[model samples]
Target: MNRILIDSSVHHMRIAVVENGKLVELHWESKAHQSIVGNIYAGRVENVVKGMQAAFVDIGQEKNAYLYYGQERATTDSNPKEGRKLKMGDTVLVQVTKDAVGEKGAVVTEELSFPGRFLVLLPEDTREIGISKKITDTEERNRIKEVLKDSLPEGYSAIVRTNGAKKSKEEYQKELDVLLKNCQAIQQFGQYAKPPALLLQEKSPALRIARELYASEVDEIVVNDRSIYEELLQAGEFPQEDGVTLLHYQDNTPIFEAYFVESQAEKALEQRVWLKSGGFLMIQQTEACVVIDVNTGKFTGKKSVEKTILKTNLEAASEIAAQLRLRNLSGIIIVDFIDMVSKEHRHLVQEALEQAVRKDRNKTVVVGMTELGLMQITRKKTRPSLEQQMSVSCRYCNGTGRYPSIDWTVSKMRREIESIFSNTIYQKVIVTANPKVLDAFCGKEEVFLKELQHKFEKTIVCIPMQAMAFDKYHIEKQKDS
Candidate 1:
């Protein structure tokens, strides 16, 4: 059975999907500090750069949003403005397309879409009704198309989601009514509101995931936070017939700790993943792409070398796909599979890897292997990877992942001592360094400390700072006793 655990007890929200007691995906969100993407707004045109074919919109954010006229042509061309270009102080309804990354502000568009449980209601897009490609059953697809064709309100249309395949007519009408009501509300709110104001806020991360994933495929939704649980219930996305259980965890123990998902999450952040076959995968992420190297760790086969390599490569392929989803690593991915001598074996591994990534909801393309024997993949990125979100550059290494050797650290300390005593007027000198750095001062280096004390005619004390970086040191002087 599949279970979704939502832990909102902390300041940030953590949502995890567990299938048969194993964690498959985890999503983290914090609304207070992060950018607000997918939010609808009434924005004011601060500046229109006709040459750049873009406009800077003030959505009441620190940096103005960028809206490309070329990209906006499809969505905004039908606006009442006709052919007139957006001018300063012009009020336009926009939705955030992407969040702020680095120096770039949020990307907004005039294309407004309201997502419901089973359909995405396009308020401005009335041209046609579309069906989800995943719902490939011809008869069911035709039934859904006919149903929507019969009752689709005039001047408004929607894209039927995959979850709508088995839904009842009453269910369709109920959700449609709610979506229509929201569209009318947004229009009314836009009428009263001025530019640079939020018309509708995006659903919280927990609620959003619940709506998208709560079809018959999901078994249960367990939320540790009462407020989020209540919100999911109010959303009315889950049907009780799917053995779906919604339980508000009233106990003091957090859900992750109880389910042992915290440890699984920690492992996902690691670069090396050990497969059950004793083979392992080394994952590395860079600005260019993500590279995964397959290795045979301890697995030895009684069969030929080719068989051993093929078996390890097959196991690595499965783990690689799972790791990508768990880590939320996207962009171009290159997998270095253990080279199989047989052409048939190589084909099998490639097909196995492709099938494994199908479990991931994100769109991914397996580009197959190159002549040089590198397997390439392209996965769409919706947000930052787990490691990128959780970690920062080290203070000493500054992201180089390297630090000065112990001998170099000791020599640097000597230079720092001389410079400090010559400039300052004080008796006792206190030197504090990381515990690892101080390890060099043990019996042998103690002699150097004694010499420095004699040369300076002052007392010098070495203290170990556990929390300090190995290359970091602090020196302080005191008055004569």
Candidate 2:
């Protein structure tokens, strides 16, 4: 039976589902000052950039929203003489596709989808009846398709989720009717609602999980929030089981720790994941891709070297798939398995990994192993990864994972002194930074400080601030007498 746990902390929220003894799905949502994405907006087109084939939109935010020309659907009713043209001051119904990161504005699209418990409702296009690829049973797929065909409006299409695989046609129709009503309400509201208005908002994380993740196998849904618990009870039909329970955690310890999930969560964030067979996986995530290296940490099998490596690689294959799902890591992923001598061993390890990832709800494609003993795979990215949502780039190394050398620090200090002396306004300057930078400059690079005094003709003082980052320093100009 599966168990769903929600950690609804004010700073960050995490949801984890455990099936049997393995972690299946985990998601983290950050509550930083940044606006949440997927929010529908009533936006005004500020400027139409014909050169870029896009427009800058004002969505009542600091940075203007970005709308690409490709996001606009081609209409057959467009004027033949005028062609497609969007001018300034035009009001558009837009939904945020991507969150604003760094300097880039939020990416907006007119194509919007509302997620329901059993199906995803697409209002604009609906002729096709789609089912999740995870549902491999042809008979179950046909059953869901028949339910959708009979229940949905003429213009709407429904993608039957994997959760609806074994459900009766009557049961599937009931869920579809709820979604259809919800969509109709949203459309009616959108007609009279002010521009830059929210026509629909997704349900809370707990309800969403119950709808999307809960199946007949789920033993219990535990929640700490009393209000949300009551809401879930009234929201939909929960799966029935003999021992199934809805638990309300009222302990002093956090809900995650009470369930012994905190330690597992902490382990998920670490760089190394160790298997019982003494093999380990070293995971490193970069902006471009995630790299995983398999190693035989300590296990020397009671067999030949080839057997040991193959055994370790096979074990790492299953663990790699588990970690990918638990962390929700996406984009290009390259896994370096311990090199094997046998062709059969390689094929077995590859098949093992592919079979494990096939159970994932999101689409995953295992492109097999490369000649360099690497396995390449990709998973559809629906949201920012757990790491991206919870952590920021380090300030000290500026994400390079290394601090500046003593010589580099001294050289930068000398340049700063020279620039400060040329100004001629400061009587003294205080340099403050981490102990390493200070120790490097004051201990090994003291000669450069002396030479800078001779060159710049100014008194420079360096004081280490223990609170400063390793590569960060503050400079303050003193008042001249």
Candidate 3:
């Protein structure tokens, strides 16, 4: 059974999508760090970079937002000023399409959209009606298209979400009315709002996920926080006939710990994943793309060599898809599966991967295998990955994941001490270094310390700071006793 577990009693609101007993997707939001995607903003153009065909707009954020006008023709809407050229200090209503990652600013666009429970309202879109590609049944698609065609206001368009296929016409019209009202309010507010003002904020991450992901497969929606649970109830988010049970968790134990999601979440952050077959996968996220290496560890199959390698690759194909969603690893992905000489075997592995990724909410495309036996895939990235959201770079290694060698650290410390002594006139010096570094610097029986004092013609005292970083130290002149 699939479950949507929400732990919102804590400062950080966490929501996990569990398939059977395994965690497939995890999402979290805090007040200090909130997603701005789908938010409408009245922004002021700060600079127009003609060379890049893009303009930087101040949207009341630390980093100015990036707006590319090169695709204006493609995004032409019903507004009279839709494709107008932007200049410095121009006020334009825009919506954030992508959140800020690292040093980059949020990517905003003139084409704004408002997402509802069953449809996404596009106020300016000329297209009358659109349906989700997931609703492959031609009869159902036509049914929804016809219902929306008559109910929708002229010039406005909407895309029916995946869950909309199961809803009745009355439900569609109800949601459409709400979305249209919101669109009108945003437009009215944006007209009078000053530059760099917020026109409309999107729904909270928890509600957004519940609204979009509570499809036919999800059986139960469990939330620990009473307030969010009540809000969901009041909003009529779940249908009574859908057989979806909404439960308010009243257990004393934390929701995540009770559900065994805490341990699984920690495992998701790990670099290596062990499969049920005893084979392993090493997933590494780099600046450009994610690289997954499949290894046949302890699982030496009873069959022939070809069969053993093929079995591991097939298992890896499924796990890679699950891991990509669990970790929210997006953008370019290259999977190095165990190579098989047979063309048919390779075909099997690729088909398995494609089938697994079909369940993903994000658009993931398996771009086929390369000449080097590497399988290439791409997932649309709009926000930071799980790793980037949950952790920061190591301070000691400066994100390199490697520290300076002990010998190298000692040598560098000696040079720094020499330079300090040469530049200052203090006779007595005190040095504080990491405990391990101090042991190496002091040498056997304090021989290195004595030699340093003798060479510099000054008194030296070496103090060991256990809390200090591996390669970090402090030096200061000692006061007269």
For this target, which candidate reaches the highest lDDT against the unseen true structure? 3
Off by over 4 Å in 3: 72-84, 402-481
Clashing pairs in 2: 42-196, 126-157
Task: Find the number of clashing residue pairs for candidate 3.
Answer: 0
Name the better of 2 and 3 by TM-score.
3
Model 2, residue 30: C-alpha shift (Å) = 3.3
Task: Compose the digit string of candidate 2's lDDT tens values, residues 398-471.
Answer: 76653443433444554455556664577677888777776665554576467546655667677877887655
Question: Which run of 10 residues does model 1 get worst, by summed lDDT?
Answer: 75-84
Candidate 2 accuracy as TM-score: 0.72
- For residue 359, what is the lDDT in candidate 2? 71
* Model 1: residue 378 alpha-carbon error in angstroms: 1.4
RMSD of 1: 12.8
Q: How well is each residue in 347-430 modelled by candidate 1, as lDDT tens digits?
A: 999999999999888888999999989999999866777766555445566664534444434545664565566656777878
Candidate 3 positional error at 199, Å: 0.9
Candidate 2, 173: how far from true, in Å?
4.7
Clashes of each: 0, 2, 0
In candidate 2 the C-alpha lDDT for residue 345 amounts to 96
Candidate 1 wrong stretches, greater than 4 Å: 44-56, 63-91, 401-481
